[model samples]
Target: MRIGELAGQAGTTTRALRYYEAHGLVRPRRAANGYRDYDEAELRVVREIRALLATGFALDEIRPFVACLRAGNPSGDVCPDSVSVLRRKLAEVEAYIERLEAVRGQLREQLGGAR
Candidate 1:
Protein backbone atom coordinates (compact mmCIF):
# COMPACT_ATOMS: atom_id res chain seq x y z
CA MET A 1 0.00 0.00 0.00
CA ARG A 2 0.99 3.63 -0.36
CA ILE A 3 1.23 6.30 2.32
CA GLY A 4 -2.36 7.47 1.83
CA GLU A 5 -3.75 3.95 2.01
CA LEU A 6 -1.76 3.16 5.11
CA ALA A 7 -2.85 6.44 6.71
CA GLY A 8 -6.48 5.71 5.95
CA GLN A 9 -6.20 2.19 7.30
CA ALA A 10 -4.47 3.42 10.43
CA GLY A 11 -6.96 6.28 10.99
CA THR A 12 -4.20 8.83 10.78
CA THR A 13 -2.86 11.29 8.19
CA THR A 14 -0.17 10.87 5.56
CA ARG A 15 1.62 13.80 7.21
CA ALA A 16 1.52 11.93 10.51
CA LEU A 17 2.87 8.81 8.81
CA ARG A 18 5.63 10.91 7.36
CA TYR A 19 6.34 12.31 10.80
CA TYR A 20 6.43 8.81 12.22
CA GLU A 21 8.82 7.76 9.51
CA ALA A 22 10.99 10.78 10.23
CA HIS A 23 10.95 9.93 13.93
CA GLY A 24 11.80 6.30 13.20
CA LEU A 25 8.43 5.05 14.40
CA VAL A 26 7.35 3.69 11.03
CA ARG A 27 9.69 2.82 8.22
CA PRO A 28 8.02 2.55 4.85
CA ARG A 29 10.16 1.62 1.92
CA ARG A 30 10.56 3.88 -1.07
CA ALA A 31 8.89 2.74 -4.22
CA ALA A 32 10.46 2.85 -7.69
CA ASN A 33 9.03 6.29 -8.24
CA GLY A 34 10.14 7.47 -4.76
CA TYR A 35 6.74 7.06 -3.20
CA ARG A 36 6.54 5.52 0.25
CA ASP A 37 5.27 1.97 0.09
CA TYR A 38 3.90 0.49 3.27
CA ASP A 39 2.98 -3.06 4.14
CA GLU A 40 0.17 -4.33 6.38
CA ALA A 41 2.63 -4.76 9.23
CA GLU A 42 3.54 -1.09 9.01
CA LEU A 43 -0.13 -0.28 9.17
CA ARG A 44 -0.39 -2.27 12.39
CA VAL A 45 2.60 -0.37 13.74
CA VAL A 46 0.95 2.94 12.91
CA ARG A 47 -2.21 1.87 14.74
CA GLU A 48 -0.17 0.95 17.77
CA ILE A 49 1.64 4.29 17.62
CA ARG A 50 -1.63 6.21 17.40
CA ALA A 51 -3.18 4.19 20.25
CA LEU A 52 -0.22 4.91 22.51
CA LEU A 53 -0.23 8.60 21.56
CA ALA A 54 -3.93 8.79 22.35
CA THR A 55 -3.10 7.48 25.82
CA GLY A 56 -0.80 10.48 26.37
CA PHE A 57 2.42 8.65 25.58
CA ALA A 58 5.15 10.86 24.10
CA LEU A 59 6.86 9.76 20.90
CA ASP A 60 10.05 8.93 22.75
CA GLU A 61 8.11 7.22 25.51
CA ILE A 62 6.45 4.97 22.92
CA ARG A 63 9.78 3.85 21.46
CA PRO A 64 10.03 0.76 23.64
CA PHE A 65 6.60 -0.40 22.53
CA VAL A 66 7.53 0.16 18.88
CA ALA A 67 10.73 -1.76 19.45
CA CYS A 68 8.74 -4.53 21.03
CA LEU A 69 6.40 -4.66 18.08
CA ARG A 70 9.30 -4.66 15.63
CA ALA A 71 10.72 -7.57 17.61
CA GLY A 72 7.61 -9.58 16.59
CA ASN A 73 5.75 -9.50 19.89
CA PRO A 74 2.00 -10.17 19.67
CA SER A 75 1.45 -7.05 21.77
CA GLY A 76 3.80 -4.10 22.05
CA ASP A 77 3.73 -3.77 25.80
CA VAL A 78 4.89 -7.31 26.55
CA CYS A 79 8.61 -6.55 26.50
CA PRO A 80 10.56 -5.54 29.58
CA ASP A 81 11.36 -2.08 28.18
CA SER A 82 7.73 -1.46 27.36
CA VAL A 83 6.70 -2.71 30.80
CA SER A 84 9.17 -0.36 32.42
CA VAL A 85 7.76 2.56 30.43
CA LEU A 86 4.24 1.65 31.56
CA ARG A 87 5.37 1.50 35.18
CA ARG A 88 7.00 4.89 34.92
CA LYS A 89 3.96 6.45 33.29
CA LEU A 90 1.75 4.93 35.97
CA ALA A 91 3.85 6.47 38.72
CA GLU A 92 3.75 9.83 36.99
CA VAL A 93 -0.01 9.66 36.68
CA GLU A 94 -0.35 8.74 40.34
CA ALA A 95 1.85 11.64 41.43
CA TYR A 96 -0.11 14.01 39.18
CA ILE A 97 -3.39 12.80 40.69
CA GLU A 98 -2.04 13.37 44.19
CA ARG A 99 -0.99 16.89 43.30
CA LEU A 100 -4.34 17.62 41.70
CA GLU A 101 -6.15 16.36 44.81
CA ALA A 102 -4.08 18.64 46.98
CA VAL A 103 -4.86 21.60 44.74
CA ARG A 104 -8.54 20.73 44.77
CA GLY A 105 -8.57 20.69 48.55
CA GLN A 106 -6.94 24.10 48.65
CA LEU A 107 -9.46 25.44 46.14
CA ARG A 108 -12.34 24.10 48.22
CA GLU A 109 -10.92 25.72 51.36
CA GLN A 110 -10.57 29.06 49.53
CA LEU A 111 -14.17 28.84 48.30
CA GLY A 112 -15.43 28.10 51.81
CA GLY A 113 -13.50 31.06 53.21
CA ALA A 114 -14.83 33.35 50.48
CA ARG A 115 -18.36 32.33 51.43
Candidate 2:
Protein backbone atom coordinates (compact mmCIF):
# COMPACT_ATOMS: atom_id res chain seq x y z
CA MET A 1 0.00 0.00 0.00
CA ARG A 2 0.95 3.62 -0.33
CA ILE A 3 1.60 6.18 2.38
CA GLY A 4 -1.96 7.49 2.33
CA GLU A 5 -3.44 4.00 2.73
CA LEU A 6 -1.06 3.18 5.56
CA ALA A 7 -1.78 6.47 7.31
CA GLY A 8 -5.52 5.85 6.99
CA GLN A 9 -5.19 2.32 8.29
CA ALA A 10 -3.08 3.49 11.23
CA GLY A 11 -5.51 6.33 12.03
CA THR A 12 -2.68 8.84 11.68
CA THR A 13 -1.81 11.57 9.26
CA THR A 14 0.73 11.25 6.46
CA ARG A 15 2.97 13.76 8.20
CA ALA A 16 3.16 11.51 11.23
CA LEU A 17 4.10 8.54 9.08
CA ARG A 18 6.80 10.59 7.45
CA TYR A 19 8.09 11.75 10.80
CA TYR A 20 8.21 8.16 12.05
CA GLU A 21 10.22 7.21 9.00
CA ALA A 22 12.57 10.14 9.48
CA HIS A 23 13.02 9.18 13.11
CA GLY A 24 14.05 5.62 12.08
CA LEU A 25 11.02 4.10 13.77
CA VAL A 26 9.42 2.81 10.57
CA ARG A 27 10.87 2.13 7.18
CA PRO A 28 8.90 1.78 3.98
CA ARG A 29 10.23 0.59 0.67
CA ARG A 30 10.52 3.06 -2.14
CA ALA A 31 8.98 2.39 -5.51
CA ALA A 32 10.80 2.96 -8.78
CA ASN A 33 9.38 6.46 -8.85
CA GLY A 34 10.42 7.05 -5.17
CA TYR A 35 7.00 6.80 -3.57
CA ARG A 36 6.74 4.95 -0.32
CA ASP A 37 5.37 1.41 -0.31
CA TYR A 38 4.32 0.16 3.07
CA ASP A 39 3.52 -3.46 3.87
CA GLU A 40 1.34 -5.00 6.58
CA ALA A 41 4.33 -5.50 8.86
CA GLU A 42 5.14 -1.82 8.62
CA LEU A 43 1.55 -1.05 9.47
CA ARG A 44 1.77 -3.21 12.58
CA VAL A 45 5.01 -1.54 13.62
CA VAL A 46 3.48 1.89 13.16
CA ARG A 47 0.56 0.95 15.37
CA GLU A 48 2.91 -0.33 18.02
CA ILE A 49 4.91 2.90 17.89
CA ARG A 50 1.74 4.92 18.29
CA ALA A 51 0.71 2.84 21.28
CA LEU A 52 4.11 3.37 22.89
CA LEU A 53 3.96 7.11 22.32
CA ALA A 54 0.56 7.20 24.02
CA THR A 55 2.16 5.63 27.11
CA GLY A 56 4.53 8.60 27.68
CA PHE A 57 7.67 6.91 26.44
CA ALA A 58 10.09 9.35 24.84
CA LEU A 59 11.14 8.54 21.29
CA ASP A 60 14.72 7.77 22.35
CA GLU A 61 13.55 5.58 25.20
CA ILE A 62 11.20 3.76 22.89
CA ARG A 63 13.92 3.17 20.30
CA PRO A 64 15.86 0.62 22.32
CA PHE A 65 12.65 -0.97 23.56
CA VAL A 66 11.33 -1.11 20.04
CA ALA A 67 14.31 -3.23 19.10
CA CYS A 68 13.62 -5.47 22.03
CA LEU A 69 9.96 -5.66 21.06
CA ARG A 70 10.81 -6.62 17.50
CA ALA A 71 13.27 -9.23 18.75
CA GLY A 72 10.45 -11.01 20.65
CA ASN A 73 12.35 -10.65 23.94
CA PRO A 74 14.33 -7.67 25.09
CA SER A 75 17.97 -8.63 24.93
CA GLY A 76 20.37 -8.61 27.92
CA ASP A 77 19.85 -8.59 31.64
CA VAL A 78 18.54 -5.36 33.15
CA CYS A 79 21.59 -3.16 33.54
CA PRO A 80 22.01 -0.60 36.27
CA ASP A 81 21.17 2.20 33.83
CA SER A 82 17.99 0.55 32.71
CA VAL A 83 17.04 -0.14 36.30
CA SER A 84 17.71 3.47 37.18
CA VAL A 85 15.49 4.67 34.40
CA LEU A 86 12.75 2.33 35.50
CA ARG A 87 13.17 3.39 39.11
CA ARG A 88 12.98 7.08 38.29
CA LYS A 89 9.93 6.69 36.15
CA LEU A 90 8.32 4.58 38.85
CA ALA A 91 9.02 7.22 41.48
CA GLU A 92 7.50 9.87 39.26
CA VAL A 93 4.36 7.84 38.78
CA GLU A 94 4.16 7.00 42.46
CA ALA A 95 4.52 10.65 43.37
CA TYR A 96 1.76 11.59 40.97
CA ILE A 97 -0.52 8.93 42.45
CA GLU A 98 0.25 10.08 45.95
CA ARG A 99 -0.58 13.66 45.00
CA LEU A 100 -3.88 12.57 43.52
CA GLU A 101 -4.72 10.54 46.59
CA ALA A 102 -3.93 13.52 48.81
CA VAL A 103 -6.19 15.67 46.69
CA ARG A 104 -8.97 13.10 46.92
CA GLY A 105 -8.58 12.95 50.69
CA GLN A 106 -8.72 16.73 50.91
CA LEU A 107 -11.86 16.77 48.78
CA ARG A 108 -13.49 14.20 51.02
CA GLU A 109 -12.48 16.15 54.11
CA GLN A 110 -13.88 19.33 52.66
CA LEU A 111 -17.17 17.64 51.82
CA GLY A 112 -17.48 16.21 55.32
CA GLY A 113 -16.50 19.49 56.94
CA ALA A 114 -19.05 21.32 54.80
CA ARG A 115 -21.82 19.09 56.06
Candidate 3:
Protein backbone atom coordinates (compact mmCIF):
# COMPACT_ATOMS: atom_id res chain seq x y z
CA MET A 1 0.00 0.00 0.00
CA ARG A 2 0.86 3.64 -0.29
CA ILE A 3 1.51 6.13 2.46
CA GLY A 4 -2.02 7.50 2.27
CA GLU A 5 -3.57 4.07 2.52
CA LEU A 6 -1.42 3.09 5.47
CA ALA A 7 -2.27 6.33 7.25
CA GLY A 8 -5.96 5.81 6.59
CA GLN A 9 -5.94 2.22 7.75
CA ALA A 10 -3.86 3.12 10.81
CA GLY A 11 -6.24 5.96 11.73
CA THR A 12 -3.49 8.54 11.55
CA THR A 13 -2.39 11.36 9.28
CA THR A 14 0.03 11.11 6.40
CA ARG A 15 2.08 13.87 8.00
CA ALA A 16 2.40 11.84 11.15
CA LEU A 17 3.48 8.88 9.08
CA ARG A 18 6.15 11.03 7.51
CA TYR A 19 7.27 12.08 10.94
CA TYR A 20 7.55 8.45 11.92
CA GLU A 21 9.61 7.82 8.83
CA ALA A 22 11.85 10.78 9.56
CA HIS A 23 12.33 9.51 13.10
CA GLY A 24 13.27 6.06 11.75
CA LEU A 25 10.26 4.45 13.35
CA VAL A 26 8.88 3.28 10.01
CA ARG A 27 10.86 2.69 6.88
CA PRO A 28 9.32 2.40 3.44
CA ARG A 29 10.70 1.78 0.01
CA ARG A 30 10.52 4.36 -2.76
CA ALA A 31 8.82 3.59 -5.99
CA ALA A 32 10.27 4.42 -9.38
CA ASN A 33 8.11 7.52 -9.28
CA GLY A 34 9.56 8.40 -5.82
CA TYR A 35 6.30 7.63 -4.05
CA ARG A 36 6.62 5.78 -0.80
CA ASP A 37 5.75 2.10 -1.07
CA TYR A 38 4.75 0.59 2.23
CA ASP A 39 4.50 -3.11 2.92
CA GLU A 40 1.65 -4.61 4.92
CA ALA A 41 4.00 -5.04 7.85
CA GLU A 42 4.35 -1.30 8.07
CA LEU A 43 0.69 -1.13 8.99
CA ARG A 44 1.32 -3.30 12.02
CA VAL A 45 4.26 -1.06 12.97
CA VAL A 46 2.19 2.08 12.61
CA ARG A 47 -0.54 0.63 14.82
CA GLU A 48 1.98 -0.28 17.49
CA ILE A 49 3.53 3.19 17.43
CA ARG A 50 0.15 4.87 17.68
CA ALA A 51 -0.98 2.59 20.47
CA LEU A 52 2.16 3.26 22.51
CA LEU A 53 1.92 7.01 21.94
CA ALA A 54 -1.69 6.94 23.12
CA THR A 55 -0.58 5.37 26.38
CA GLY A 56 1.97 8.16 27.09
CA PHE A 57 4.98 6.25 25.82
CA ALA A 58 7.61 8.56 24.38
CA LEU A 59 8.83 7.89 20.88
CA ASP A 60 12.29 6.97 22.16
CA GLU A 61 10.77 4.59 24.67
CA ILE A 62 8.80 2.97 21.85
CA ARG A 63 11.91 1.98 19.90
CA PRO A 64 12.37 -1.31 21.76
CA PHE A 65 8.80 -2.30 21.04
CA VAL A 66 9.24 -1.49 17.38
CA ALA A 67 12.46 -3.44 17.28
CA CYS A 68 10.70 -6.35 18.94
CA LEU A 69 7.96 -6.27 16.33
CA ARG A 70 10.46 -6.10 13.52
CA ALA A 71 12.27 -9.07 14.97
CA GLY A 72 9.25 -11.27 14.12
CA ASN A 73 7.83 -11.54 17.59
CA PRO A 74 4.13 -12.35 17.88
CA SER A 75 3.76 -9.14 19.89
CA GLY A 76 6.04 -6.27 20.92
CA ASP A 77 6.06 -6.98 24.64
CA VAL A 78 7.47 -10.48 24.34
CA CYS A 79 11.02 -9.20 23.89
CA PRO A 80 13.32 -8.47 26.79
CA ASP A 81 13.99 -4.87 25.68
CA SER A 82 10.30 -4.13 25.41
CA VAL A 83 9.65 -5.77 28.75
CA SER A 84 12.32 -3.61 30.38
CA VAL A 85 10.79 -0.47 28.95
CA LEU A 86 7.37 -1.54 30.20
CA ARG A 87 8.72 -2.03 33.69
CA ARG A 88 10.41 1.38 33.71
CA LYS A 89 7.34 3.18 32.43
CA LEU A 90 5.11 1.40 34.92
CA ALA A 91 7.39 2.49 37.72
CA GLU A 92 7.31 6.09 36.53
CA VAL A 93 3.53 6.06 36.43
CA GLU A 94 3.34 4.51 39.85
CA ALA A 95 5.60 7.19 41.27
CA TYR A 96 3.51 9.88 39.63
CA ILE A 97 0.36 8.41 41.13
CA GLU A 98 1.94 8.46 44.55
CA ARG A 99 2.83 12.14 44.20
CA LEU A 100 -0.67 12.95 43.03
CA GLU A 101 -2.18 11.13 46.01
CA ALA A 102 0.02 13.09 48.36
CA VAL A 103 -1.06 16.36 46.76
CA ARG A 104 -4.69 15.32 47.00
CA GLY A 105 -4.29 14.72 50.71
CA GLN A 106 -2.78 18.18 51.13
CA LEU A 107 -5.66 19.69 49.16
CA ARG A 108 -8.17 17.98 51.39
CA GLU A 109 -6.48 19.31 54.48
CA GLN A 110 -6.48 22.82 53.03
CA LEU A 111 -10.16 22.57 52.26
CA GLY A 112 -10.89 21.36 55.76
CA GLY A 113 -9.00 24.25 57.32
CA ALA A 114 -10.67 26.79 55.02
CA ARG A 115 -14.07 25.51 56.10
lDDT (10s digit) by residue, model 3, range 1-115 = 9999999999999999999999999999999999999998899999999999999999999999999999998788899999999999999999999999999999999999998
Q: lDDT of each model, Cα atoms only? A: 0.93, 0.76, 0.95
Instruction: Please identify which of the two predictions, 1 or 2, would achieve the higher TM-score against the true structure.
Output: 1
Q: Candidate 2 on 1-115: residue-level lDDT in tens?
A: 9999999999999999999889998889999999999988777777767876786766665565555445554331144444555576678889999999999999999999998
TM-score of 2: 0.69
Worst 10 residues of 3 by lDDT: 69-78
- Candidate 1, which ten residues in sequence have the lowest lDDT sum? 36-45
List the candidates' TM-scores in order: 0.97, 0.69, 0.98
Instruction: Estimate, for each residue in 1-115, the C-alpha lDDT of model 1 and write its tens digit.
Output: 9998998888999999989999999998998999999888898789999999999999999999999999999989999999999999999999999999999999999999998
Which of the predicted structures, 1 or 3, would earn the higher lDDT when compared with the native? 3
Clashing residue pairs for model 2: none
Q: Which candidate wins on TM-score?
A: 3
